[model samples]
Target: MSTASRIAIVTGGSRGIGRAVASRLAAAGQDVAVVYASNDKEADAAVGEIEAAGARGIALQADVADEAAVTAAFDTVERRLGPVDVVINAAGVMALQPTRELDLAELDRQLRTNVRGTFVMAKEAARRIRPGGAIVAFSTSITRLRFPTFGAYAATKGAVEALVPILAKELGGRDVTVNAVAPGPTATELFFDGKTQQDIDRIAAMNPMNRLGTPQDIAEVVAFLAGPGRWVNGQVVFANGGAA
Candidate 1:
């Protein structure tokens, strides 16, 4: 892949799906800013991979849920890399708990981080992105599956799916596309932690592919949307491999 002059920002780019998306963009020749919450080490590692792929890379630390921090992060990226040509809102949290046992604080955190943070990043991207740029937000198959303990988390992702069309309309005249990617089960740290072999097997069997999705699996779709698939706007492209 040859690099384009485009610049991209991948929130939560320090690890997992975000990191994969960042690397994909880099492979396509876009300078990438890998944003992380706290760990500069992980962010640096991602940046190194991007540089190795022959694209310029930078690591920025910011809390996606905090408005000021998010604003600063975007501003820094723009200052360093010029106007963002692509924005992938992949920063989110998953909190699992039955409704009766769900703590109010945890519920609030999930909503604030997933829903509000997405909104903040999208709004900022709408304002700052280049005319031909694209924005991709993260949703989850859990929104459709509606698992019992995923009420709050799924609700937040559902809100994101609902926003895609409106955002696409808002950015229409500017030739910017807005979309969301809803991924099913992926073998990320989030899924592996606190899972026994039995739990892992059950989760894997839930997917028709008989295996969990990989971060790269999801990133490939994101790369398409951010590049050639610009015509596909206001859509929630599910990359779950028939899991949902």
Candidate 2:
């Protein structure tokens, strides 16, 4: 493929895997619109990195699930950076609780951010992503492992997994490949947020790699799907190191 620069929208690009993907794409010579829901500072820093990598960087804020906001954010990116050639839907949240005792609010929050947000971004991507463009979404290995407290969280990811293949078919004629990257336990701040060190270690050990995945590991896979992975449509490429 040509090495000409492309434009991309990377949702939740302020930190973690999102940041890594945005930076990687930029390093690969793609102008990146780093979308962040709330953290402008981190978003600005991410954009700076993208620019420093010799690609344009623009920081736009929007809730991935909010229709009007998402539309406007995409519009701004298109206006400033040209039509988006790739979209990485990395904006998501996770909550842990048993099904019976799960907090209704937390469950709704997860559904809104993960399921609805993914659909909203993906539908828009289907509409605007250029031919040969790619759309990458996030799922979770928890969906495979079926751990006790992750039922709700996994359910949302499972929803995305279901959405990907159909969307890939929807975009088949247009050459826009759609896929998801389901990662196993990662060492992001999100993973260790409330866990004890022992808890984190135990979870890391579950992976056959004998260590947790890193944001960069996930980003590398996302980059493949975004650029060179033209033939890999409608697939969920798991990056868990055999944890699941």
Candidate 3:
């Protein structure tokens, strides 16, 4: 089917990489549903931008970890837009601390949002996504870097990565593709939080490109997978500028 007839739901679409992905899909002529957890205004603004791009857009609020909320969000998309053709699980949190010093509550929160939330969305998508649809889950290059204080966060993403191939296999003859995108150090608020200028520069210098990845850069990869990159499935594509 043409992109103009497709529908996409992007979790965490209010800001950051998720917003970029939603915008890119809209630009590609797909209807987009921008799913946010708490920010109504930002979600509305995102929908405005999508509409400005000349595509149908709607903002739905749902915590990614909440299965009922996610199901309702999908139902809204199907009713207003169409049956979902793409689902991008981009809503997540990062709490960086040494594993030895990390609070169990923090660990639980990360797992809930990153792992359980991804599973919930993936499960829903598996059931509802149209044939020839695609599911993109987010991971992190930190899983490869094995960086300190990233233990818990990486663990959650690692679980997401593990789900990709297995889910693709389960989908079997459905012709739906499941994959993960592991971004390296990116210039997003989530990556910049609690980091010093020195730390930022150091990370930016780690890649051969000598710069952090942009949300658009990562979004382009997603757009490819969602549209024409069907043969590439059940794999983790690192959009990290050779940082890993």
Candidate 4:
């Protein structure tokens, strides 16, 4: 997965899959801007890893759902790293509860980061990404699994999936790619927050590999899309190890 050096901006790059994506991209010779909502210490450490991989790295703070903040983050990336070639909206939130008892406030929170965040990032990427650039958004395989308690979270990613192809077509002449990576039961803080050991084991066994996905596993798919997988545009890639 070799690619010419390019500039990439990864939201939520301070941790989990986004952090892996940032390090992976940098290792592949891309200058990376790690956009995190907060947690400057973790963000700085992520940049340290990127720089350790021999690529220029910086950390920026912004609320993904805030249009002005997103715009400013992009401006900073452009000023510090040059025009962005890859924009990955991996900033997301999850709240798992049955629809009957779902928390409306939690739903709102998920909507803000997952749906609105992607919306803002996609709009910015469409406007600012260079020719031949790529935009990647996070989705979840829970939509296909139809699991209980994932209603609100899946709904937001569903919105992400819906938005991707439409944006791809809207950017038809620009040579930029817009796609979503829908991961299944990944082993991240976001995924493990509520699950018990038994819950995790059962879910892991459902997949053929009998395991949960690693953030790095998802990052590999994203790295491909961000780098040389230009032909695979406007699709939701299910990187779930056949869980669904």
Query: All candidates' lDDT scores?
Result: 0.89, 0.91, 0.93, 0.93
True lDDT of residue 14, candidate 3: 97
Cα deviation of 186 in candidate 4 (Å)? 0.7
Work out how many backbone clashes candidate 2 has.
0
Of 1 and 2, the candidate ahead on TM-score is 2
| Model 2 C-alpha lDDT versus the unseen true structure | 0.91
Residue 2, candidate 1: how far off, in angstroms? Answer: 8.0
Give the local distance difference test score of model 4: 0.93
Name the runs in model 4 displaced over 4 angstroms.
none
Give per-residue CA lDDT, model 2, range 3-99, as digits (tens): 3578999999999999999999988889999989899899999999998989999999999999989999999999999998999999999888889
- Regarding lDDT, does 1 or 3 come out ahead? 3
- Candidate 3 residues 1-244, lDDT tens each? 4677799999999999999999999999999999998999989999998999899999998989998999999999999988999999999999899988999999999999999999999999999999999999999999987889999999999999999999999998999999999999889999999999999999999999999999999999999989888998999998889876
TM-score of each: 0.96, 0.98, 0.98, 0.98
lDDT of model 1 at residue 8?
Answer: 96
Separate clash counts for every candidate: 1, 0, 0, 0
Full candidate order by TM-score, most accurate first? 3, 4, 2, 1
Candidate 4 lDDT for residue 91: 91
Instruction: Evaluate residue 61 in candidate 1 and report its C-alpha lDDT on the 0 to 100 scale.
Output: 88
| True lDDT of residue 117, candidate 2 | 98
Q: State residue 27's C-alpha deviation in candidate 2, in Å.
A: 0.9
